[model samples]
Target: MAKYLPPLFTRLYLSLLTAIFASILLTFYLSEQFLQRSDVVDFYEDSLQVFIDVSSYLQRNGQTAEQLFKDDTVLDPEFEILWQKNWDANADCEHCKFLSVIANTAIYQLSDEQLLAVYPLQQSEEVILISDKPANSSIFSGDRRQQNSSLITLFRNDPSEFIPYLLLLIVIISLGTTLYFSVRRLQKQINQLVKVNQEFGRGELSARAQKNYTEPVNELAQSFNRMADAITETVSENQIFAQAVPHEMRTPLSRIQLATGLLRQRKLKCEELVLLDNIDDYIDDIEKLTRQVLTFSKLNSISNQCDHQAKQCIKLDDFLQGRIKRLVVDNNLSINLNLQALQLECDPAYLRLIFDNLIKNALQYAATHIEVNLKVSPKNLIMLTVDDDGPGIDNLQFETIFQPFSRLDKSRNQETGGLGLGLPIAKAATRRINGHLFVSHSHLGGARFSCQLPLKVP
Candidate 1:
């Protein structure tokens, strides 16, 4: 669970829980106060009932004592005297008293017992006082004291009065502090990680993040590291191989090249010269092989070099005719050209290589005709198609035909001479120039290889 949640989310969850705990505490405090004060409300009601009983007793009529009470002579001829005598007796009788007094002598004067207050009501001129005197004559001071002290005790202990609000304030402050610190810590780690990433991107390969990555980023970094390590190791191995391979092949190739040159210059008899010609042919094949190996090595070293080189716009119809003319003169091969005067933007050397491989493949298998076609579209695309009347490839082998060292022809004889990297190298060169190459069935009942090149305007 801890790992599933980010630290920020975890902190937020804790903050919410803290807030809930505080709220619950505050609610409990209020509820407890309400329960405590319930008894005080009942005490107030009892005081009201005692006052009603005293009022009823004062209204009673009797003999001389009643007449004297009515005349206010024996009652000290003042309402205060009557009220005090009865109020004090009731306080003592009931043994509970909860009252206070506030008086003004200019108005009705107060006696010994503390007068709570006398305030005029809004609609009437009559003033009423709720004093620290018992309402009933029968209730004693001891009885009143019990109820009075209980009310004061309840007010003191009731949590609803202030504690709930105090607790809420503390909880808000604490949660805010916790959130602030957690955000600051997370921000610091994130900023540090970003800085490290920027340094690494700028070729500081040794740089690393302080905090562990958030899953996706970690996996991405791991993949990049793996790829970088593989490239580094492979480059080191290639450098070693490049140094050794040329030295090993150089001795044999130098001898073959020397023998071919000598044979070309010497004069001899017919049969003897024929033997020399055969030797010369074998030497030429060796030279070609050596050259192919060197070219392959260079291609491997810089696969994208073609894209960086300058390009020229060449006419397809004129170019094909020239190429076919050259091939017929050099290799004694017959050719037929079928193309439009379409212009293409490409590196001439690479484009020549593409057509050379396709034409050579055709010449090897073609019975009579090697058909070439060039198509153009308004969308800046040029398609070159080469077809031959030869044994076609199976659909299952189509994808494998483009692999290096892959050849459908089983025989490895001089008659069908090739290093098998021709087509693959052509494909790589085409890709470097952002071209597409694919093979399909031809009209001549053989394989048709088509290459599409984007013809951008100079």
Candidate 2:
């Protein structure tokens, strides 16, 4: 599951999750601390203001503080006064501590049972307002004390707080979800374009991307389609030229061969006989080049047109045995075969292009020994390898070696280095049959040409 998702997707998933939850938690905490209902705020502020006003009034009027039952003159007061006492000014309470002092009013450290406040009057007396906490109060403090202390309780008492919190949460979640799905859709479209490109690479020149995509992707598809169009036009014209020239030259080539054969039968000097032999060799090389180009042209134009039955399974071991025996008899080279009995679905043309060139090269370059291995892989692939103890190729030349007319062996006389289309033909035909061919350092102290083909054709 971890490997299936792209690295960008995994990183975005974690980052978005952390951002959403962390933003929500930070917003909720800030709202609980600073943004709150008006009445809840007024409760604590009014306590200090009311006490200060009364204390000033008592000093001006020469009267004592009002008692709850005895103060019938006061009506609808904000605080239900439980008790008031004359305390020593500038003296701390024995059991409780001073929380803060504002405008000569000292806020006491409240107890769970009572709300306590102290104020100094005339620098001689401390008037303390103490009341038993009401069970059915309008608010509950965060500290569980009887005083109103927190804004979180606003959610239970007011819809305004909860509504904003819920809306913020919903908006955060919705944005993250939208971004996630947007990227996922983009990745899906990119994957589809990649698949189309693979099909075109496999010789399905008609494969193209559809226009049902979002921007950037749509523009990229258009660019690829334009490039494919130009390449297809160029390749079609070149294929026609390649096929026509070789075919038209065949008539002249045949005439030359026939004239040389007749001239050899007649009485001629020794130099004239050598010239005829040279003409025969030149005709053969041209014929070989024409055949190579024609074979490659046919393979290059493959468009998946083979019928289902054309891809037939054959006994691979038997197929190689016959071909290897014939090649050995013709070349007179000592070659070893390690074959496994396996069935593989293959096109005969592609098989010919692959083994004919591979075995031929081994015979040409090998000093004295050659080996071939044919076996089934654990991945259900048919593996074929040909090894030779010749001057092995350098690693730097591996890529260029598969290109047409590429000969790494520079000092070849007429007997060696046949037209250098063999490796390119083998490589192209490997693609035609949906296989991979690669070169490795051989165990026999030379070059190894390995081909891996799927057991079932796609």
Candidate 3:
């Protein structure tokens, strides 16, 4: 039964209801306690007032009854008068008995029937009975010798008693009803979210989570729909990317196969040898193209799956130095390095690609020198800049230069025969590492490519 129920809404509803009921019950109990206490205090004060009025009258008549009310040490008291003065002196006195009778008489002056337990002034041990009228017509009647001397008690438990309780019940029911509707509304919203999430998981990219017309759930629904639209667009792009792969590979593979057949015959001329070199270059480009696709796919796939892991940290200076050394030694491009000691959390292979493509493109255009600079900022940003001394890009075309298959010419003429995916590939790789890449005018009189990547602190 517990497993069948969804936990979040269940827990939320239970908690809210519990709090509401608890507050209602606690308030009811506390209010009742306060009312009862206040009633008791008010009754006690009335009894004290009656005692004072009667004692003042008796004192004016030279009766010793007034001496029975004051205590030495206590600041405020209600029952001290009941045992004040000598015990034996007023035990059998007629005057003391009369005084008790008069004190009890004063109680009937109030609205409610009041009971009194009075003691004598001279002998604090004797009981006194006082009333406004004779004993047969008295509303104030109680045993004066009763052990509990707090005799004046009034109770009013009419409609007022049940009114507050009814109000409390109403409050509880209101809260429970409110919580029930709220949970139902919340469950509906969650169902929409869950349905959309399930569709997404099943690769239904166009599916959306629709929401109620009257709530913020509508905004959330819109957001989910937007995300689904983006996912659908991305899926379409990837499908196109995957479909184009075979067509893109056919040209190079056909050339390599044909060139190999010709080479095997041993009848290849000097011109044919150059064609073989061209075939090898095509093979290399194809291989690199396949690697770029795989790299891009892996980066996108794993980015959503993994958190930042320190094991992925690459020492910035060492990693860049190694790549720079390889490019210089193997490609023989005049390259200079100015790198700093910085660590970065990233896949080292992908990071290498960003630099490799940038440098490779620079070498293709550079006339004399290629410069690489790496700097670590106090704000924990790793900045890498690569520049070349060649024909700089036209100011108007800088933004369009990074688009796939975009170049000075649409056909990408023999002088610049690349597919024009290098800058875009580099940009994608930079995004994978939560980095930014851009192009600007270079100090080397050519184009400069700069990347800002987050750093890993030791």
Candidate 4:
């Protein structure tokens, strides 16, 4: 079953809407309760005044309670009078009391859903007064009583009675719509920030979040941009340092090579010649190290600018054959190639750099033979592999070897004249063209450098 998860803004909107609706409902309920209580208190005061008026009328006329009751049955317009002589005969009325206490006036509900107020006459003989319409309808059934009461019957029967509820509905809809758009705007900004952060994490150091000062999220965007700036500056400085150190060392290396060549030309003993050969080997190692460092730094710089770099559709087969032929002449190494006539869209300089590093690394380590294979997949992906017949790399070193300045062993470094930057430069060059480079155990009992690149330019 798929979990029902909502987005952050959606959850926030729902929670806010629910809180608002509940608050409005609670306010309405409490206000209705307060108004009902106020109405009840006013009705009690009016009823007490009416009772006092009846008592005053009997005293002003110089008449007794029994004579006043018999003469005038109706006392006020708001209430009716009922003379009950044998009230004890009714079992329900046995517990009923005279008007000696203010609580004696009680509300009586009839069988036909009508409300009646029953009050004692406060006389010698037992008598009660009743009212068909209570002093306040709210005293009985709260606001619901006003719905059926005669006072609001005309309003309820009219069509316009729905106006208040209709207005309330419109207000709720307007609030919801406003919240929706506001949340959507916030979500869009947040998504943009997230996308930029993801791209930055993926090594696009130039990626930055767009800022809008009018928005609240602009503060976050500002912080993100600052962080990106710091990281990009740091990486650029490091690349500059890497390139600078190599360029400074190259001059001394060239002088050392000249001195060693001149020394080797002198007539010397066998042991002395061997010492000169060792010096020559050491010079070659230093030269190789300088070249690798320069290439590594250049690849790092180019990868950062790959987006604006020009790319060309180059024939892969012809390109590999020319590069292999040149390497063969330089290193006197036997290399086999199985390349297809496929066109690839990439920076030709970077592509040649990638192949040169891989093929040179293979030739350096291979005992007898090296193989280069290039093919296009069904998905239009270019796959290139370079394998050798030397001892394969340890599985653990597959990733370690691609790190700059990483070496498997000191002996291998000395024998191969490598400063462990060939594979790293190759990897960087592959990435410049939106490609991946990885190494695995080759079928020929050696390391296999595999590269996958998209045929279509990105």
TM-score of each: 0.48, 0.77, 0.48, 0.64
Name the runs in model 4 displaced over 4 angstroms: 1-7, 10-15, 29-167, 170-216, 302-309, 316-342, 356-398, 412-417, 439-450
Which residue window of length 10 is worst by lDDT in model 3?
Answer: 104-113
| Candidate with best lDDT | 2
Decoy 3 TM-score against native:
0.48
Better of 3 and 4 by lDDT: 4
What lDDT tens digits, residue by residue, belong to model 4 across residues 1-458?
23687877888999988877777677767876696555444555665576677768867988755677777566887655455554442454432222222376654433122333455665454545443444454223344333455636755666475565666677678898999898888888999899999888767787888867346799999999999999889888988898889789878877987887787788878998888788778777877777778877877762455555667889999999988878764445567788887898778888988999898788777888888999986777899999998888998788888898787665535555467777788898888777999999898888898999987867
Q: Which ranges of candidate 2 are over 4 A from the true structure?
A: 1-32, 37-48, 61-76, 80-188, 258-268, 307-309, 330-332, 411-414
- Tens-place lDDT per residue, model 2, 92-142, is 344444455556565554453334455444545535453334555512233
Query: Model 1: how far is 418 from its true place, Å?
Result: 2.8
Candidate 4: residue pairs that collide = none
* Candidate 1 structure quality by residue, lDDT tens digits, 1-458: 76876676456667776777777787887887685455434434443444344445445743332243456443211122223222232432233233332222111112223223233323444332333444554212344334444645756867455655577677767876777676566556566666866655433445554426555556655665575566556765884586468668779777876876787687767898788778777766665666665555554453333444667878877888788776654344445566888877777777787887887787777776678888885666888898988887799988887786677865444466366777887786676566888999988888899988887632
The TM-score of candidate 4 is 0.64
Clashing pairs in 3: 86-123, 100-129, 100-130, 101-129, 101-130, 104-130, 104-131, 105-130, 105-131, 105-132
State residue 35's C-alpha deviation in candidate 1, in Å: 21
lDDT of each: 0.60, 0.74, 0.65, 0.73
Q: Is candidate 1 or candidate 4 better by lDDT?
A: 4
